[model samples]
Target: MPSLPKPRLRRPARGRGSAVAHAPEPETPNVEVVEHDGLRWVNIVQPRQVDRAWLEEHFAFHPLDYEDVFSRNQRPKVDEYEDYLFVVLHFPAFDKQVGRLNAAEVDVFVGPDFVITLPNQPIQPLEYLFTQAQQRDDVRASLFGKGAGYLLYKIVDDCVDASFPMLRKIGNKLERLEEDIFEGRSGEIVRDLSNAKQEIINFRKIVRPQRSALADLERTKRYIPDDLDIYFDDINDASERIWDMLENFKEVVEGLESTNESVLSHQLNDVLRVLTAFSAVMLPLTFVASIFGMNVHVPGQDSITAFWIVIAFMVGLLGGMFYLFRRRGWL
Candidate 1:
């Protein structure tokens, strides 16, 4: 088979300092679709490079949207331009072996006749959509013509669905960590909990803003078809649920940290108590030895029998101190 063409790199139309300009170095794949047969069936593949000038000549995408396409680390949001809808969505993937979350950035431009998607990395949702578009005859039939809105809705919906598995994995990991914390596995468990909490926080940061953006999209009266409003509402609901899940997870993590600290503090107090008891028992014994070791002629130092008497006296004195401390509940 012939090799596919290399993807083009396209610079934003605006200057480098522009708020929505594309990154100078393109690290994501650009996917574009051409509608045909009153159905929209477009092959989804990552272009090796994107040519902004070429896109300008061929597609009528707004300059700002194009800049968004090339921009690195664009915040999740929705911007409706005069002729197109621009949106950024986040899809998170958890790598079990690595114990981390990988968040992919997907940027989209929906025009009257075409749809363009740019991703910071290859994401599973787009791959699944592309594969289904090719292999499923029903999908192929509806995707091109009357079902463009439906197709867009399905893509966003699928992305939201994909997040659930990652969330569940995180939830499970947290549960295990909670068990470990309770079981007295302090050191490693605490570190892992910290890392997991950070990942969840970062994920929430990406998700919450997107939730607000979706809410705004739902409220606006615009070119979006009436039938598609429900789909957007579904997306809004899913985003809200994810937000809530993250918040709950954060609270659980905080509780785990606090519990871990309390356990550690208790252990430290136990150790200190043992040390203090030992020191108390030895204090009188040290005093007895110091008096006998005096260089001047002392009452107990003159005879051989005096050493035995001193040893007996030291033992009795240590015994008395132990009894007193025990009576005071200090031992």
Candidate 2:
């Protein structure tokens, strides 16, 4: 047979490539979109109280879910619907003004062909990850080539991984505080321990509820379209590990508080012991001076030799008392 006829060329679009099957979706004030390889990722940043109508207009999420999304400080949880799954996850984001970690809540909706992320606050890692998948061809291929389930797993996994660095920072701070506790810096260490303890408590509050939610993820499926049990398990394991670390930190901080209190108590006892010893030594000398200073017939009041003898006797009494204190181990 002769060579095949030259293929009739279908010209690519004028602006964008042919691989993009649809025109780009317009973004609203609080919403952004990234599409690649037939997968769509919608990211909503800090939606306002009235923005639930937008979500309801686009997605058939439950009213309660919308309430949870717009609400502040919702507990971390996972709610499985008939055609979608709603997940709430938390990560510690530091608040520089208050100088502590605050829980950033991200509500996710996973469906057959799309993944939606609605964060209650600006999460830098989530923002960065979404941007990477949106801008970089390789990142988009790697992340969107997989199904929605796998993409969801990666999103949660990246957030879970970001916590380790914060944990490391907390660990280093505790080590330094442990050293300062013994270096006569208990005054400062007391405040340090309080701040660290508060951070641990807040972080634990974030991780504890989220652990159960992540564990329930694999079972709560509808349109996820992939058997990502292993991937979800990995995220679950990471959440468990984070919770364990926070538990350990709680105990460590409590122990530090007790140790600091003990050090302070010991220092107080040392000061009080010195004051008591000095007061005991001065009692007899004070009585002797008072008696001689009175306008009464004291024994050594009339003679100069008597005054020298009295002075010598008082010096001997002082030496004797000092010797007694040294022998009693109370000096």
lDDT of 2 by residue, 1-331 (tens): 1221242555546655536566565444566778877788888888874456566667777888888887885887888877788888888899998888988989999988889899888888899999998789999999999878888988889999999999999889899999999899997777789989988888887887888887778666565555677778788788888888888888888888999999999999999999999999999998877877898898867899988887888899999999999999998
lDDT of 1 at 66: 70
lDDT (Cα, 0-100) at 88 in candidate 2: 88
Give the 10-residue window scoring lowest on summed lDDT in candidate 2: 1-10
Measured over all alpha carbons after superposition, the RMSD of each candidate to the real structure, in angstroms, is 8.8, 9.4
Misplaced by over 4 Å in model 2 are: 1-28, 49-51, 224-227
lDDT of each: 0.72, 0.83
- Per TM-score, the best of the predicted structures is 2
* Candidate 2 global lDDT: 0.83
lDDT per residue (tens digit) for residues 194-309 in model 1: 89888898788778777877787676544467877888899889888998999999998888888888888887887898799898778768877887787888985668798898
58 Cα displacement, candidate 2 (Å)? 2.6
Backbone N/Cα/C clashes per model: 18, 0
Q: Which of the numbered candidates is closest to the native, going by highest lDDT?
A: 2
